[model samples]
Target: MQRETTGLLSPGTHVVEVDGLSQRYHVYGSGPVCLAVPGGPGVIWESLRTPALEEFLTMVYVEPLGTGGAQRLSSHPHGYTRERYARNLLGLLDALSLPRAYLLGHSHGGFVAQYFALRHPDRLSGLVLFGSAPVTGPEHMAEAGARVQEFVERNEGQPELPRVLAGLQAVGGATDDEQITAALRDLLPAYLAHYWAREHEFKAWRETLTCTYISGLDEDLTPDTVDDRDALPSLGVPTLVVVGRYDVICGPRWAQELNDLIPGSRLVVLENSGHLAHVEEPEQFAAAIRDFVTETSV
Candidate 1:
């Protein structure tokens, strides 16, 4: 029943084709499973790949529909919804013979994780919500505007500061994919607690990841994730919500909401981190996940 090769048994990344769609999963490590979902909804696995966590857990970096190597089966606008994303996660688990595994969702991926927890709680051993939120649309747009203004005020010397601010406002209302990607580049600096000014590192990262904006995904993400005030608290799954103290995108306020709502979820706010805590503060990030997985697996 397995085409050319669907499940594991390789060192490099591989694809799982089932029911007219293919999901690319980058597998690492050899212990407890942590199905780590990358943010950006379409960003490369590289951004969310954790070498540190792999030392303690089997990390499965998933590329959701419309991102990286993933291919969506349906062209219907409704096909790209959050529930569809959750279904793919569930399908991947079944294809791998993984009855259940830890779900770690970062940024927008956390939204997908939350939906998965709601629909398929029985298939999750635990859940990790990293640098994510409970509600994001107009409020998220407002947050981005505020953050950009704050940074632009102090960084007037940077020639592109004004342009970045313009781009921030533009990305939210972006109609086409090109505008969205350009806006993503303009707003990139705000997500970093460190290396925001490190031109070399920033440039290299931008070059490699580019402006990973997947068309139609913005529609899929924004409108669907309404307030989770009632849903999160009811979740019986063990949960961990990790955030960066300086991450204005998801921010501490949103993280607090998640921790408070998710009954027994543990919250870890790294002192020296922003949007990408796993990259910004690897040691602490890995340690927290290691401890949680160990305790929960027991």
Candidate 2:
């Protein structure tokens, strides 16, 4: 796979200044609006860039705070909280003069989406949660940790993946930036159903994933205090909950919980994917969004 082309990677972006902070989002395609909120708290939406979704809707990727020069100006200790992220998203819409738009969030971004839907149900036409969880911070981390243990136990031969991932905890990666990235690479396979079968997608993602300012933003982006377990079902908006069959992090457990809690929500398990279903199955992923947006736009 020749990866030199930057067709979808590069897109025109418009930055909106709110409260002395700049919120930037890469805009692509032209159609009904769909805001793409990325995960990793610190990881920018650039990591999840895919052109397929743009084909169906005008895609706007909202960068997480402290990314792409959009530095955070907040003095709050929980500056990276999900509430802040959701507000920033709403601010982006206001800046762009969009009354409402479709919201698609992956992993941690999914948490932000939930809060946004809960906080401002009138501002959303539809919602998509891809490989995301609906649990509190402690439960969220426990779920991930427990699944990691299960992954190691279930996969008999891949003893080295977890071992290398453990080394990421030491000072070597802490002091050296490249080591941190390399260690993250070692953990990528666990997010895929079959590493060897879809190594190309993982390799391509690894080459592009970068941790910038607010590197530890993921530390505070969890549902620390914004658990919407009971509130989600009342959002009363069309929702799509998607997960990869082998996504250990946000596996079937989270998917079922989301589907069960959100009334009239559609759950789709991408049979051949892991954490990055959009990367593994972009066409199908994009199609699902298209159909949902279309069905709900009446």
Score each candidate by Cα lDDT: 0.76, 0.73
TM-score of each: 0.88, 0.85
Q: What stretches of model 2 exceed 4 Å from their correct place?
A: 1-11, 74-78, 167-182, 213-223
Model 1 ranges off by over 4 Å: 1-9, 76-78, 153-156, 173-178, 211-222
Q: Lowest lDDT 10-mer window, candidate 2?
A: 1-10
Best TM-score among the predictions, by candidate number: 1
- How displaced is residue 58 in candidate 2, in Å? 0.4
lDDT of 2 by residue, 7-104 (tens): 32235866667555777778887778888888755565776787998786888888877654566645432357776788788877777777788998
TM-score of 2: 0.85
| Sequence-dependent TM-score of model 1 | 0.88
